[model samples]
Target: MAKQVCMGAMMQCSMGMAPSSLVPTPKTVMTSGVMAANIMDNIPIMNIPPFGMCQSPSNPVVAAATAAALGVLTPMPCVPATPAPWAPGAATVLVCGMPALNDSSKLTCIWGGSISINFAGQVTHDIP
Candidate 1:
């Protein structure tokens, strides 16, 4: 079973240089002092904060910077471009009428980065 994702959960992006913490909204019931999360909780900077620097060539900022640097790879500040919600969340669990976010769930950035949970924030809450 995967642990339910909650506020302060740690996440890392494939093209990111550092990990960022998940900031779930307060629209759902509390899991363990902090609010639990759902698939739709992914709202870019509001929920999913930046993951340090981004190295994806698909990102316009990085691409432009790299091109300006004479083909040298230039990493820009990571501003996660999550256009959609996390996938493969807890299908058996519901939060705010949506699939509850689980530790094993994955979120994709528009810049071709795979975001994954490094820590689920709490150990007691598990979901199928």
Candidate 2:
């Protein structure tokens, strides 16, 4: 009797498809998977911080190849008599295509490499 009823239902379903169960569907599953992937892709971009703004100077500060040299090379508010690990102010660095330093320049430490200022001084940067 049960088999007969199932066969009858199958025949009816073949003629006109029965309604799907009111539960999980393929669209819901695919949407969830895509949403999960999208969330993961966004995480890394959010973790990135703005250029030249690190928690400490020890961290790398990635910036454009060309920017205001003073802001990119040194800390704000000029301090005299201090030699930066990489470059120092009042020391000649190529500014606006000519070697110059204004009163606004200050001691600054770059992550790596050294710079020598002619008729001035030299700065060495030691990177770990």
Candidate 3:
């Protein structure tokens, strides 16, 4: 990954290097209603191209076992959206942080969580 220093925020990765080819090439940006159109056109199976997640494992075997266990076990606290006293159905809502950028030319990064409660008027669970 190649990074560029722009107006201070360590902007994002400018161009990604191919493992097979060590070419430092320029990336093209398209304004045709798609964010990663140019990058996706050249790469196959590149849904949401040029973006990926890198998981750093503190302990590989432990992490894998924990994930496998979580897949089979049920969640301890399942909080559905509880409705107000007057409302009939439960109303689920999420609160999200502001996006990093509003322009089409820039990337937007947002983070947030969901609000969950039980009908028994207890704030049971939250994960963000």
Candidate 4:
């Protein structure tokens, strides 16, 4: 039988290289349909490009695992309404942060246009 590893235990463990532990504390925010991107709450400000714009993990391994474990934890790619507009619909946006304690009250959007996108999944800070 395959050994089962509990994500909670790993996260809580004192392991040095644990990817999950590297994630910063997440915060919840409400969308106001504003043009400015809502900065991720309680995370280190590291400009890592694309992912940095959304305050996601700069490490590829951590990023992939985080995305798999916590669905919609990263910004998604979207076709812009124009060729190169800085508007919300014109590009990908990070409307959600790392899930915590089975809650995702932080999920939000800033897309200001007639276009709409749908994402479905549960949030969990636990990573396996």
Listed in order, each prediction's TM-score against the native is 0.93, 0.14, 0.14, 0.14
Measured by lDDT, the strongest candidate is: 1
- Badly placed stretches (over 4 Å) of model 2 are 1-34, 37-52, 62-128
Per-residue error for 80 in candidate 3, Å, reads: 28
Residues 25-125, candidate 4: write the lDDT tens digits: 22243222211122222222121011122223543444575588775445333211212211222122343432222111221212221211111121236
Error of 2 at 108 (Å): 27
> What RMSD, rounded to one decimal, does every model reach?
3.6, 33.2, 19.9, 17.5
Clash pairs, candidate 4, are 80-90
Q: Which tens-of-lDDT digit does each residue in 30-77 have in candidate 3?
A: 122222111111221221122122121222433464477874322221
Q: What are the lDDT figures for the candidates, one per model?
A: 0.92, 0.20, 0.20, 0.24
Best by TM-score: 1
Give the 10-residue window scoring lowest on summed lDDT in candidate 1.
Answer: 25-34
Comparison by TM-score, 1 against 2, better one:
1
Error of 4 at 42 (Å): 10
Winner of 2 and 4 under lDDT: 4
lDDT for model 4 comes to 0.24
Model 1 steric clash pairs: none
